[model samples]
Target chain A: MLVNVLNVISQWAIPLLLLIIPLYGFIKKVPVYEKFVEGAEEGFRTAVRIIPFLVGMMVAISVFRASGAMMVLGSLLKPITDLIAAPAEIMPLAIMRPLSGSAVLGMAAELMKFHGPDSFIGRLASIMQGTTDTTFFVLTVYFGSIGVTRYRYSVVSGLSADITGFLVSLYLCHRLFG
Target chain B: MLNLIWLFLLVSGILVAAWHGNIEVVTSAALQAARDAVEVCLNLVGIMALWLGIMKIAESGGLVNALARLLRPLMVWLFPSVPPDHPAMGAIILNLSANVLGLGNAATPFGMKAMQHLDQINPRPGVASEAMCTFLAMNTSCITLLPATIIGVRASFNSANPTEIVGPCILATASAMVVGMSVDYWFRRRNRRRRR
Candidate 1:
């Protein structure tokens, strides 16, 4: 019941905002189109500005993946995962979640396809993917856009959250769906 | 730290590839990743323009500020470094709201806008301010109410109940948020003391 309500809200949210913002602007005698165009000009510049940062971050991530480092890491971490009774298949998803968004999403879909979405692995993967954002990508784009080279402890904080999310997802999935 | 991670990825990747005799794969992956990065940025341009334009209109109509005011107390508490009436507060609020609603595309532009606003007030150029770090922490681990894309992916996989993970997802995300905020707070205090 709650999911249905959230689904409707998520679907309608953008369209509603698109309508309401301009309509409200028009009613308030604001030149909505002109303002929109002015703001949009920055969009092009912002996208261009983050190009170097994105390339640097993505190349490293891709190289890491292409070199089969993740698989090695997964194997190395197998003992702990086994001890916790978590499937080895889900380890790659957890490791990749904070590094790259698309990579983890692809893994989650593949897991669901291979294991069936109702299976424990599929459900666990789904929750893990949903609960965590791509920390490295976010840090790169957001901080890079503003040229913030000294991010201080942002990385530490983000990874801590991601780790917490992973553990919580594992525990919750086991209790709820196992 | 980012410097360390970048070096670690590159160094470890190359070493691992050499160990496995897969150096060519790493080389090709690097080139492909660079190209894909540009593609991702270009794709973002249109959506960024659309959202930024809408946001511009909202700002002009005072809607952004009004919305910010509606949640003034919460905004103040979350981002004390920002003035309650500042445009940064509004943009940050919009970004978080979009994130909560699972509007990833909308959230990005709003987040960029917020960062721009936050940067304007930053005393140190090229350094993340306290508010920026706090914002990033919250953003990277925000409580997700609707993980729309994941649900769609599950449904496409023929799950009997695609939304079954929603409750668990929310619980996990909420716990993540709590920890993220706490860690960010602790770091902020430590940094301040060191600076003093």
Candidate 2:
């Protein structure tokens, strides 16, 4: 019981600290950040402009899932997945794109729910979730906000990180847990 | 209109590639996926609101400024273009700190604020200067400290040891940042040579 309580407290600690300090801002209302406010408003406008782009990306991701391309891809990559120590069940899904982190998580959950965490599917999910981030989607929104038309090395570099992450996670999982 | 056309084509392409079967299933699935994203974002709203309030308070309380003062030397070395006491520097530090703690939704406004401050530094109206590009690179590859979202997903997925991911998360993010910064430096140097 005590251990569980400690775990809960640790989880909530940073969030609570984050909340308490901001009360200071509300009380003071410094004039310095007024320019910040104006800038933020501008950024908000940029965010609005980019929503259509995000929607398109999301819609595309959705359609891909619906069309069953994900499954086909997963099956074809089974050999590589096996090589990398990735959960064979979830490896193809991880390779799909950097956009839908949650969808992949959801898929991982489904796999784990039935198979158990130490199972191939569950460990793969755990590793994938830990290893990579939503690089392309985030870059689009961020760079779009600032109006960067030329993202020369960004695409390859970001995806390279994602792929590197996938392979590493696979290797780590098998080495450490398997 | 043209952007929208490009968007439509992109969506159609994904749908065409991914969905091979019944139209209804594919269409409904696509819609649900978007909805799921929104739903997750909505769930995150409370945390974001709390963090926003905290960030605002920190800014008002002058804590952010103090933090910037501490970061001064390093910031100067990394971003010589932006002078000390600059709002961009403050916002950049704040954004990095917040992102380190795994508050992405919270980090964004500060990121925007940083960019806006960068915009102020830029003499050119539309074109991004080198500093701006470097900052973008940094922001994109910034190291995440906590990996909150991943942990949450792990807990939800019934992992016995969600925290085990902490090590790999740190290593992987650090690698990306290193690679990103190196590439950014190489390109910047190459550009300078061309100018010389």
Candidate 3:
């Protein structure tokens, strides 16, 4: 019952923001249309600017997958992940989650379709996706747009965080849902 | 770091494919990935344009500033290099707020704008500033209050309890945020000490 209520609230949060922000802006007499067009124009330019970076990362990801490296790596990591009680099946999803959101989403959906969402592996995949961000995608798009080539320590920190999120998802899934 | 990763991916991919006599797979994957990249960007353009437009109205109406002021204390601490009232601070606050609400599409525009604003005040044009790294760390481990996308997927899959993972998701992401911020803080202090 409480979960239902929370879920409903969460569902409405974004819609409410979408409604309220604009409504509030209009009430305040802001030139909403003009400003929106200006920002949207910038957004268009940014979208174009990021195409090269997106292609580079996506190609790398596809190459990694097509070469069977992901499968090889997954198999290699299976024993370790199993030892930690993390489902070996979703190992690829976890690895790809920080790389490409769409790819990982596809993987997660496949896992759920195969295992059923209520299954342990499916739940774990969902939690993993929820808890982590596509670190490389964000880094590439945001930094690449502005031509900030020297990311320096950002990647380290971002990946470390992803690792932390992944582990925590595993541990939590086992403890709470197992 | 990105360079090394990209290089590693390409070299390992090609070498492994060659060893496996699956060179054909590599060629197809590259072509497919290129197509997928364009599709992803096209999708992004529509979402980004819509949200950025909404955000522009919010910005002009001072809603973003109000939100930023509310987040001022936290922002001041997290991004010490940025001024409290700077447009970057507002953008960061808006980005984070959007992320927390599971508005991923909405968050990107604000995040990109934040980076631009941060760049405006950046002393080094091509290099990421300390604040940028910290912001990236925070964003990568963004504390998600609701994993709505996951819930929707679960619902579609007919999960008995689609929302059951919410509590765990929140807990896990919170821990990630804590860990990420600490590491970022440690790196920043170390860099400062080295310069000193």
Candidate 4:
């Protein structure tokens, strides 16, 4: 019931605000268009600087997968993962969260193909689908942009959160659904 | 310096933990991981380029400007320190828009520009201003409306409705932002108390 109301409110909010802001800007002759252009130019350049890091992280993730390092890590971490009841299907999400999108997608697709849709693993994969933000990747980009040299605490905190999700979700699946 | 020690400690821990089970395999795998990393880097070359090209065109065609205007209110609320007319606010809006659409690939530069703009207004030369920390918190935990990459992957694997993940994705991210903001606020407040 609440979600429906929130959704309804959201549907109108952006459109209404967009209409009102520009109308106000134009009436005041605020040069709204040019100001927007100037701001956006900075946005464009900001996108460019992220290339090297993205490339590096992508390469690292690919190497891990290609060399079977990730599999090894999976095996090494098996005992812990089993405790959480994390199926092999969602394991890559654990690894890939700190990595990139394409890498995770590759893993997700492989899981879907190998484990059959609607199976336990499949549902877990589905759950994983909507969950998780790229914690390390996000921090690297945002903190690095601002030249944050001492950003260690958040790294530990974010990874702990991911681990928390892993443990709880695994417990839920095994005890209830699985 | 200290980070190197930490990395060393981590690597050693991994080696020690996996020693009895398959040390040699783990070692070889780590090397292989490095090699695979290079290959993965090659694969992404094209995808990133295509996205950047689209972003470039968006900039040239004034689509980015439209995006900024579209997200202005959210930007204002997020970065209350930056004046409404500030270029930083515009950059921030665009950065956030890219993030909302699951375009982390596109949002990096905008994040930088937002910081650069924030930097100009930094009253403290070395320390991050209150607004800057808040901006970082918001960006790091920016709520994603669509988990585009996940949806695409689900679709690639032939999910019935790839976009269904959007609901869960939005919920998770919004909650994360709320938590993130509260923590950030707490830290800032603590810092203020200390200064006083």
Q: Which TM-score value belongs to model 2?
A: 0.76
Candidate 3 local Cα displacement, residue A26, angstroms: 2.7
Candidate with maximal TM-score: 1
10 residues in a row with least lDDT, candidate 4 chain A:
A54-63
Off by over 4 Å in 2: A1-49, A72-87, A147-149, B1-54, B122-129, B156-158
Best first by lDDT, ranked: 1, 3, 2, 4
Residue B172 CA displacement from its true place in model 3, Å: 0.7
lDDT of 3 at B8: 82
Q: Write out the backbone clash pairs for model 4.
A: A46-B109, A46-B110, A47-B109, A59-B37, A62-B36, A63-B33, A63-B36, A63-B37, A64-B33
**iRMS, all models:** 1.0, 4.8, 1.5, 6.9
Instruction: Give the residue spans of candidate 3 off by over 4 A.
Output: A1-15
Error of 3 at A170 (Å): 1.3
Per-model TM against the reference? 0.97, 0.76, 0.95, 0.63
Docking class of 3: medium
Kindly list the per-residue Cα lDDT of model 4 for residues A48-104, writing each as its tens digit. 454454444444444445444556667788887777667655776667654554556
Ranking according to TM-score, highest score first? 1, 3, 2, 4
By lDDT, is 3 or 4 better? 3
Q: What DockQ does every candidate get?
A: 0.83, 0.32, 0.74, 0.16
Residue B61's lDDT within candidate 3 is 93
Query: Where is model 3 chain B poorest over a 10-residue stretch in terms of lDDT?
Result: B97-106
